[model samples]
Target: MTPAQTTRRHVLVAIALVWALVCGGLGWATRSAIQLDSFEAREDQRRTDEVRMERALARMEAEIAPVLYPERARPYMHFRSYYIATEARYRSDSSDASRDILVASPLKDYRGPDWILLHFQVSETEGWSSPQLSSEARFALPAGGIPAPVRPREAAPENWFAALQERYTAPMLEQVLMETLIHSGEVEGLSAAGPRPDAAPDAESGVRTAAAESARRAERLLQMQREIHPASTCEPELVAMENLEAGSGQVLYNRETGACVQVYAPLMTPVWLDLTQDGEPMLALVRSASVETSKNCTLQGVLIDWPKLARELTEQVRDIFPEVRLKPLLPSEMAASATVRGRLHTIPAKLVAARSPPVETWGLSSGLIGGLAVAWGATLLALVAITYGATKYLTLAERRMQFVAAVTHELRTPLTSFQLYSDLLAEMPQESAEKRRHYAGILRAEAARLARLVENVLSYSRVEETAPNLRLAPTDPSNILEAAAAATAEPCQKAGKELVIENHCPRETRIETDSQFVVQILTNLVENACKYSADASDRRIWLSAAPGPGGSITFEVDDAGFGVAPKDRRAIFEPFRRGTSEQGRRAGGVGLGLSLSRYWAQSLGGVLQLKRSSRNGAHYSCFSLTLPSAPRQC
Candidate 1:
């Protein structure tokens, strides 16, 4: 290899290495940048989730205000008085007259939520009174003749209250109100599941706590109720509710003051004093007057049914946050205000959520990722193509340099022989005919060798530079074969090989081409066949013309010398790339005969191919040249 060619190859190798590094670095950087973008998106999404959660919680706080306070419905629980009449004739004495007399306050028509188990009013004047029961308090007739409120039979046998009394079941709420106003007992058994059984310090305590704590719950109401309730997130010392549902309704007002019933009755139960003291987690609102009126010890409140209230509240906030909870705060929990959101001012409950912080993604998509991968691969492919093309062209340049050197040496040998023969003929005596004739014959052989070499050199140069000058005409395939035979006849005779032509084409078959170009192309092929097959034992060359593939005429030359090696099949068609076979390597004219012939074939708008070789058979190389039958411009 030449120094310049070796240097060019090294440069190409360095360029390939550089391209590989550059492409690899670009791919790595792209991947890292995408991962960073995704991380930033995740942080952005978490911030967004926090803001949305705050707005939803604020709405829940506003909506729940009325239900918790409900101070507007306070008037419905107030008490009033009425009168009763006694008939003299119906009395045991059987008297004649009937008279009206003042009596105790009657029970009002109490219509309120069942969750509000009981309502009571405490005062110094008449002690405790409720609209659910009639009062027996007596007063002297007023100076303004105000009507009296006779006690009603609210605890009549048919009423639920009477059944409780008949069964001797102690009231859950009334006893608590009369004894311990607000204490730990109320908070004892409120569970998200159900009220736990209280250890009976005794039987009386059990009966009182059972009605308040062990009430049944409707859990199959909604799946939301099943999902998030007060119990799941913020469990309290008192209650833990799941799916803390809520409901809303218009308050019913029925103030039948001064109303009466068939009889006056109130529950007078066996007094059992509650011994437990007031504990840390009790909720109450007690108000007193500074200017003190006749009703002094005023304490009015309702003992709420917690299970029913939990359902109402959890349902209310499900839209705002599906996983919300309503949990009662312990005294310690209430004091620590830093961790609390949506804590109720009206009650000891607060709201909590049972979900995690979220991530956001905007710039990262599957399409973006896929596009980057494809682009990276495409760039690498383009680099490989450019590198391969550079290497191929470099190798071609090296082969061209070798061919030039080889041709210079070959031309010198023939020119020196021709000069030597001419000198010998001139120096011989006129009488010695045999010696003179022998020298003359040597001169002719040298002239022919020089001429063929010169012709090939000139023809190759002209063909490479531009299209050949043509004289276009109609010619028969047989006529082209005959002319090629005539041109290569001397070479075959000198090599002791017979040139044979097999013409299968019809007489009428014609080719519209430059006949001169076709003859030169065939002359090159026949000469090349004779030169390479010189060493073969069979000194015969076959030149055949036949109809070829794609409606073109084929002129093939078959030889039985050392055929082209499999490795040289493709390289032999390229300029200066000769076959490596022993016979081919020894006999060659700059490797341009077959190359120039193939060029001529293509310039005539046809194909030239090595259709058969020793690789496909026992031992023959067949070079096939096919020309177009159709007319074409010169």
Candidate 2:
């Protein structure tokens, strides 16, 4: 190899290595970027899931709060009376020594603690007597007086009062007192009052004066009650309550004065009223009706089912954050730093999500990236192929240019020889006939060489432009070989080379092919052998034909010459591709002979190929032409 060629090869190798490294580095960087993006995406998804879980937990807690603490609900129960006529009748019997009567009080329908009534004695002569204290003071009795009470036949009066005293203990009295202080107005007529207008000329003065007078009277009444019941430690305080006209129809009247009074206490148990003139305290009847408790103890009269509520909340969280898996944790197991906690009634639970978000590679879509990579690779390959094709095209073009220059030089030389020899023949007519004949022969040979060059160029151009037009006919292979050999026999003799034709084809064998094209194939191959082997020590050309496989015929042209180089053999059949050898370069023809011969053989529905060429032992080269056998005529 030449130094220039070796340097070029090394440069190409280095460039390929650099390009490969660059591609590998780019691929690795792309993979790392995708991994980083995916990690970030997972983190984002995790944060989002935590927030969603927190919201769900909060919603669940709100829903179940009331169910867990029912006392937080609003109050709905109010006081109403229930009658105890049986106890009233027993107390009214004349033989009874009990000072007070026992009756059921209002609030019987409530869920906790029973209620009762106690009627103690008070009197007009005993300073506890007043018109407000008497039940008959405001409303006159009906013609039949009051309704007769029902008596329980099995009951004993003595046992009943003793049992009542035991049940209404000190704690019960305190509870009733507290209830009176807290829910007095709420339970009875006091709650239905507002401020009243005064009848005096100065309204503000009249209100103050009336309030002072009412206080004095309440103080005097309280003192009288204390004197009458000296054994009791209960201290009753008076409170002023205004009356509003919009109140419901249950008015509490002061039996002593026979006037409406908003100042009253809740009647869960009984208190003494100074009703009779006899000095014995008359009973205030107390009865209890059913009171609603559950409605008052719950929010909006509805109880929440916490388990179902928790489940629904979990499902909602799952729907919103599909990638996160929620695991419920027990109250003890729940960490303070956990993502979120949920409660159902009093039960505590925590929401735990999966440790990682769903598996995915982030950044650009994988399919899009893959598609781009494939397209980029395909485009790169296409570019490389285009570059390689362009380089080959340029090389072939340079060779063709060289071939054209060589043909031109070859044509000029023969034309100059023809002109020179014709001038000599015309000028030396008086010379000997033999000398004139020699000049004529030189002109004819030069003309034949020029004609062969021109014919090869025209034929190659024609075959390249379009498919060759072949005149198919029946012809013997030997006849075609002999004709080509005869045409070159004289040229071989003058050039001091032997031309031999060995016909191995049967006498009856004929091929269907274009006869002129077959002869041209044989002539071109033989002529090339003669030209390339001109300087051989034993110069010889061999033309032979024989029967081939599949009822075909094979024609071969062999020469004792420097065989085609191994590297150039494949390319030798390409236009303008000549052997790179001293003998081949010194030979006198353009490089179209083999290429055109191959084209013509192909046009005849046959093939022309280098059958064998060896550099060893006289450097023999052989080219073969194979054609199909023709049908026999009847």
Candidate 3:
């Protein structure tokens, strides 16, 4: 390669290397940025998941507290009577606070010396016996004034305690306790107090109305009191002992005290006895369970389905992060380095998961990398294409400049000849007619050559601007050929070259074409054949017309000349391109003949082509023109 070509190659290589380095750096930077972003996102997700699990566990614990505590208290409530209740009474006379008395049962062992045996009255008038009596004899009742006679033995402290225990069964206590635990302190009243006496009425009817209204008001007050004091019983005189209904065991919370109060809905109200004749009634018996406090109650150690909880957490987290898996851990198993753990509110458990979930890298970044690569490739291709186009444009501009110089040279030669010949003719006297005629002929010939060159230039310009204006008509193919040959006859004779016209087409053959354009094409080809073969020994030019394939007409021009080189054949048809043949080298015409002929022939709906060229001895070249045949009717 030339030094200039070598320099260009090195420059292109350097640009390619620089572009490669830039792309490589960009790719590495993009990968690093993506990795850093992914790391940050993963850490954020871990923190977010930890917070989410903590909230979920808190909610779960809140939900599970009520269920677990109630379930834990169920068995205790069921067996509360057997474990908690005894025949016990507070000592009224004891100054020492520790001297409280518990009456012992005869069926069970009693080791306490401070414990006392006290009698319970069988009838209202019969009061409790002193602790000094024996346990069996202390329960004897008075002989007379008993409204309802009872067995004296049954009133003993041990027997009364046993009866009370049997009467308030385990199942009843259990129901009361369970209700109290669940509903807290809300309860319904068993009975209301009797109405108080209103003011004296003016009439008996008025007295009756006032009494009824007073009774209704008292009933409402009792309901209100029940609601206000859900954990307490009503006053005894106001409430009719027999009218009271059994309570429905339901629990409720006391908002003021934050206490779990159980309502032992009374199974039976107090029974009154008129044992004393003083017209006063005393309570015979009242059977009811005492209210129990649930402050120390607990429901810890309740079993929680940990696997199910983990699976549920996994499902919940998967909705937010599809690739994550949540594992359940005990409080003891939460120290693993790879695992992140959070406490569950519902149970004593922890949730564990990977800090970074499994994710497919290709799904996230392959498309990004591929897109970047494609964009880089497209940009590089565009840069290379732009460089090549600019180079080609510069080369064409140089060729155009050379063509301008050649055209100027050709124009000056013809102009100089015209000037010289015209000056000689103008100065010659009228007597020397032969010399004047000779000068005039030379001037005309030179002018004709100049006109042909100018016409070719103008025609090329028109073709370049748009299409040629073809005045198409139906015409005899023979007439067009004959006219072209006749026009070239004078030029051939002046140059001392023989011209031949052979018509192989029928005389009646007609074609549709612009006659002027056809003649121009024929003239250009004939002129080219003559000028390029001027140095040949034969000095012969032949023009022929014949029928062509596809209902077309053909015209051929042949000459024995130095043929165009194979490498330059296609180039010679370009505007401003001339043959590299020896004859073409010495020729004085601009290289517009073949180019214009081909353009005009195409405009007239035909073609002009170099049929063949010979490089051997007696070199020959032939050019052919083909025009579409007109319809027979046209």
C-alpha lDDT score of every prediction, in listed order: 0.55, 0.51, 0.53
Off by over 4 Å in 1: 1-9, 40-59, 69-367, 370-378, 415-465, 549-551, 580-584, 613-620
Query: Model 2: how large is the Cα RMSD against the reference?
Result: 20.2
Cand. 3 Cα-lDDT: 0.53
| Whole-model alpha-carbon lDDT for candidate 2 | 0.51
Per-candidate TM equals 0.57, 0.50, 0.46
lDDT of 3 at 136: 54
Error of 1 at 75 (Å): 13
lDDT of 2 by residue, 399-505 (tens): 77778878988899999999999888888867479989999989988988888788778887777577776677878777787789788787687678898788997
Candidate number of the best lDDT: 1
Query: What lDDT tens digits, residue by residue, belong to model 3 across residues 304-343?
Result: 2223334555566554445544343321233341233555
* CA error at residue 124 for candidate 2, angstroms: 52
- Predictions ranked by TM-score, top down? 1, 2, 3
Q: Which candidate is the best by TM-score?
A: 1
Off by over 4 Å in 3: 1-400, 419-439, 464-474, 490-500, 532-542, 560-573, 579-588, 611-622, 631-634
